[model samples]
Target: MYVIHLRYTGALAEIDDALEAHRLYLGRQFDAGAFIIAGPKVPRDGGIILAASMDRDRLDAIIAEDPFSQQRLAHYDIIEFKATRLAPDLNLPQSPWL
Candidate 1:
């Protein structure tokens, strides 16, 4: 699993300008089963994305396609971790914490 944290680096106006395209990019990823959930931060300064486990290189390429990244409007902090647990409703493979 991965937590893709995006911190806005451009002005709000600039971020807004690219928001639509960014959303489209997210939608594509979601359709491809790369993203599980995504939303803006509480302060609206950035966003968070929960991504399904995948190859690091593939994830990087996906991130690079984000409009925020293409426009250099945000900085990304990609945190990868082993998911030792999952919600009952989520059909992930059983882990130690299951």
Candidate 2:
């Protein structure tokens, strides 16, 4: 699993300009099952994305497609981790062994 943390590097106006494109890109990723959950941060400065079922290289390639990356509106910090457990009601591909 992976947690993609994005921090805004550009001004809010610049970020807004590319928001739609970024959302469209996210939509495509979700459709392809490359992303599980995504949304803006509390202060609206950046965002977070939960992704799984892929390797780091593949995830990097996908992140490269995000408009934020293409426009240099944000910086991404990718953290890879192993899933150890989940709540009983939560279901994810990584839950198979749970």
- The global Cα lDDT (0 to 1) of model 2 is 0.87
User: In model 2, which range of ten residues has the least summed lDDT?
Assistant: 89-98
How does each model score on lDDT? 0.89, 0.87
Residues 11-63 of candidate 2: C-alpha lDDT, one tens digit per residue: 99999999999999999988777888899999998999998757678889999
- At residue 21, what lDDT does model 1 achieve? 99
**Which candidate leads the pack in TM-score?**
2
lDDT (tens digit, per residue) of candidate 1 on 1-98: 88999999999999999999999999998888888889999999999998888888989999999999999999999999988877878884322212
